[model samples]
Target: MFAASVAVLLGAWNNVVITRLPGYPQSYVPVNLAATGLLLAGARFAGTTWQELGLERRRARAGIGWGGVCAAVVAAGYAVALAVPAVRPLLADARLAGAGSGEIAHQALVRIPLGTVVWEEVAFRGVLLAALLRLLPPRTAVAVSAALFGIWHIRPTLSAARANTLADGGAGLFAVVLLGCAVTAAAGVLFAWLRLRSGSLLAPVLLHLATNSLGALAAAAAHRPG
Candidate 1:
């Protein structure tokens, strides 16, 4: 219960940082690092081994291979989505409006992967999932962690919608948040599965990086003025 509470609080804190720190994007690095430290410290306090947290190095290569496969699948799916006229507009990102190709590349290839994905995967799949497993079945732990992961994206999704002017009213914003949560929860299950299957956090981290980076690239391409 203590671990769960801490995880919830930390998740809320993460939401605040993600939504409220737009003007200070650089602050995300240190804030995420601090969150990672707290999760590691909590794992130690709860007697969770590094191996149990999927921090082992032995299966890293296999994990990376699987991650690549997952990434390819995601990229293909995004391509299909982009090709579909109905779905294409939904993927539009306002952040790309004034962003150069270099900025988009950096966001996709570097900042998101290192600054956000690693910290999130470490916290949710690594530490929180480990904690939950001690008190619940494997599947239950995954579901719970995934649910929290979905909830954690609420603020960011809403914020993004507002930034993009995608939502017109409270109802629209609510719908956007709901859809974002559901999608993220589904993705979280995939991430949790990768963590369990590979017995290493590396797989999910790579898969996540691929998803974000490729998605960003696709969005940038779509929004680029022809």
Candidate 2:
């Protein structure tokens, strides 16, 4: 329990760094990598084997395959959402409004996949979930870890809402946070399921990569001038 608490605290710190850091392009890689290292070290200190953390190679192919299926389903949902006019603007990112093709490509292919996706899976599913499983039932661990994962997004979601003015004021911001947490917690359950099913982080990593990359692509597309 102490170890799990430490891990969760570390995750909260990482979230602060991720959302509060300046010079995002310059700071993101180093910040996330350092956080990943801390999570991995914490996992080891908690007596978690690399394999148990889903860091093994034995089921690589199966993990990737299952991840692909999950990504496809998510992509299909995004497509359907995009088809709705009201939903389309929600996908827009003002930051990407003036991004060139190369910038968008780098964001989708490199920045997101290697930076955000990898570190998040390692911290949330790899370390936190592994620790929770030791202290709680599998389903319970998944739920708790997923809830933490959702909570981890609080800062980012609030930052985005503030930047986008998605809400009217304080009450609207509160509602947005609640809604975002609920949705992300549900998504976290799916991610946890992938990790448990494959017994590997590869599956969740791939799913995350697909979700972020595809979502960035959609945001870029939406922000582009007609």
Best by lDDT: 1
> What global local distance difference test value does model 2 have?
0.82
**RMSD values, in order shown:** 2.4, 2.4
Off by over 4 Å in 2: 19-25, 79-87
Q: In model 1, where is the ten-residue run with the lowest total lDDT?
A: 14-23
TM-score, each model?
Answer: 0.88, 0.88
Angstrom error of the Cα, residue 163, model 1: value is 2.1
Task: Provide the lowest-lDDT 10-residue window in model 2.
Answer: 10-19
Candidate 2 has what TM-score? Answer: 0.88
Clashing pairs in 1: none
Clashing pairs in 2: none
